[model samples]
Target chain A: MPGWLLWLTGYLVVRVRCAAPERFLNLALAQGLYFWDARWMGEEWLEIRIRAGDFRRLRPAARQARARVRIRRRVGLPFWWRALRRRPGLLWGVVSVVAAVYVWSCFVWSVEVAAPEGWQRLGPGDILAWAEENSLRPPVLRANLDANRLAEKLMLDRQELAWAGIRLAGTRVIIEVVERRFPDTATSTGPAHLVAERDAVVEEVTVIAGQARVKPGDTVRRGQILIAGIMLPEEGDQAQPGQGFSRPRLVSARGRVWGRVWYEAVGQAPLVEEERVPTGNQVREIKVIVAGREINVKPLRGIPYASFQEERWWWAWPVWRGFSLPLAVEAGTYREVEVRRHGRSLEQALDAARARVTAYLRVQIPAPAEILEEQVQVLPATPGQVRVRVTWQVRQNIATVFPLK
Target chain B: MAQGEKSSGGSKLRRVESSLVELLDLPADVVFDLPRLTVIGNRRVVVQNHRGIVAYTPRQVRVGATGGEVEITGEELQLEAILSEEVVVRGRIARINLRLT
Candidate 1:
């Protein structure tokens, strides 16, 4: 046996004989000494021996200390009995094995494949399953699905997609889409036979292309053929054989189809104004964010605004154990701005109205359309108020040409 | 022994003994008990620990002292006596002065 084993055996024999074993053990421990070879030998028995110097020190007190020590030792008997009966050493061995298996499975197992944008209307679950079947899941192939590439593929497949992109942060997948652009047929293809988009008298015809079928003074209805694309053979050429009677050719024609267009736009300015002054007040606040949600630091009271708008968005990140979150807040202040105005004469208001109407018409009509005439009439409603009506005639070449065979 | 003779003898002896005691207790350093008079020639007076006199009147007198020369209002007075310890003041028989304790 080892030297420590021999020593522990002797100590145990001495302890069994002593009346106060606790004191002896304490004295031995206090002397900066220990018996290293106290092996537990089956149930109800522990064998140990103390060092020679420790044994001498404990010898005098051993008889009295032994009894107390034995009582203390008996106090832990129930717990030790349960521990021995349960055999925790074996239980812990099994637990460690199970834990190792769990870790291995977690690191090695494959779940699902997910490509956010490429699959034509594929849902998240479908992509996950694909990833699993293909063994492209995380920690295996180490291939990350390119969201931008997926979005591009989707766009290429669908011509109607105006704008699209894919966002993949962590495991979540998001596909953003914008609708397609549709061209306005009337404006996109310029000059489609200006046959009166509205019905009116032909105030003027600035014929830029094709044969003029109607003059400025002629009255026309909606969808009336103002300029004819079909031309009849000349009288002198009628005798020629195999000469068709009529031929369709492309042509351009334009005329001002006037139909008493009336428009009313009103602008108002205040006669008096109120100003704002500092009230010398202040408030403090604290804000907290949790799980992509914000709890207000303080509630607002007596807020003076005719209208107010608020919008909120949360950003989150996935962690190994849980989620990391942050919140962004934007505040907007709304106040009334005062506008001052003074009374003006009818003639002056009329001139101002005319200038405004001219500017508006100039923006609406293209550069080629020239204003031929303008007339303004002012109807006074009150001493300082007047209603101004302005009428103008403009001429332009709005014609279309079609390919002829 | 006659009673009148005894009374004269006792009165004379008592007077002689009292005078002898007074003489023995008198201040030997003092030459005279006359008041040492100092006229400031102005209304205001200044004294330290002044005591034992009668009434004192302080008039509107601007007094200033600089470089050992004291001026009472505009009037200049030569310092007749100046002791590091105490000052004595005497003036015309207009008013008796009590020094401040």
Candidate 2:
């Protein structure tokens, strides 16, 4: 018979309670009796089993023991009985049966795995049964299979994987992967020439590796080569071996090749300005998206000065039986500020436009770029409004292409 | 005694008694001076001396005859008139009599 069944039968036989438990004491002592494994039930409780035959003999022994014991009376029979019932030896038989079943059920019944780290190769479904066999809880699985950690582990283990992560949903585990993106370095090994992006006079040239095609103070058109990476055969004997044959060579050249880029910008301000004040307006919205769906974070407020900026992040992976799970997030913020526009002279407006163009060119050109020439014109568009147009000629060394390796 | 002289003596005595009656009846106390002590109410009052021959019971009395009254309701009233138009009442005085001047 099962040890729990034997213990239950014995517990039914050797039941003993003091006539009046003194001080309502419930004495529980540890003993050597094993009908079920206690470790599987954790350390929070204890369990023990006793045989029915041994219990029948112990019953008489308990009666004799109770005769020698003295207990107080006025505490009530129910209290004393409960106190006596709580004794460890008495409850151990019942606890053993319950604990035995619990341990048996938890041994290898169900399993869940979670890895928050990316999964470069392995997924949660790949190890669900294994986790169940190991007696790991859902939370334990999630922590162990964290997507970011999983991705790191995968990257470390597999050279092909760039990154990986694992996620958990219900009993399912998801694995996400990111392939390594390699840059194109083949262009650096081939013969190619550097060409100007715009038509401008070559102000200066600095040769780094390849031969120079254009010199300073030379006017070059758009698409014209500024530096030559391919070399032609020199004047020599005809019909020579590879020595006399012309071939394209891979090389590099860098220089301060200046060119003028023209840009026309116009800025306008009304002669009569209307000041904006807070109108005490506000709006709120609630949004939800199902799978494979998207929603705008916030709609336009329709205010004159209202504008929006957006940032996006994407999370996608395979979970259990499903594939292509995507999670996208967009955040938006709204603010109210005062906006004022005042009339400016044609010259001042033109200068502002020129400054804007200069800033843009500075970002595009890493080296020093100066505005060599500017043309400004102002026309009265309305009775109270004037339109200003400014064209700027910015000179900068903008290499069309750089060597890749 | 002679008969004619006796009759004349009798007439003279009668005339004196008639004169006293006439004077007493024609408001004889009207011109007699009586010192006036006027107690108006619990708040304020005025006292004065008067040269009036007539005095009335329960009648108001005023030095300037300003229609103010002071009632005499006490016994054994005696008034000592001062030369400065001031009056002082003596004895168990309950109230003073006042009238127009």
Reference contacts reproduced by model 2: 0.00
Task: Tell me how far the alpha carbon of residue A382 in candidate 2 is from the true structure, in angstroms, after superposition.
Answer: 5.8
Q: For model 1, how does the per-residue alpha-carbon lDDT over A10-57 read when each residue is reduced to its tens digit? A: 333222333333244344444544543232233333334443344455
Each model's DockQ score: 0.00, 0.00
The local lDDT score (0 to 100) that residue A54 gets in candidate 1 is: 46
Each model's lDDT: 0.43, 0.47
Docking category of candidate 2: incorrect
The residue-by-residue lDDT of candidate 2 on A1-405, one tens digit each, is 444444334332112244422111111111212121111112221122233233334334335435222121212334445665879775776689899866554333334344444443445554543334433434343334444544465555434335555554444544455544432223354455677767778877887767788887888887788887665454563457666556655665544466666666665555555565544444433233446576655555553436322223343453647655565444333334455566766556555545554444333433467878767677557666556666677887744654433
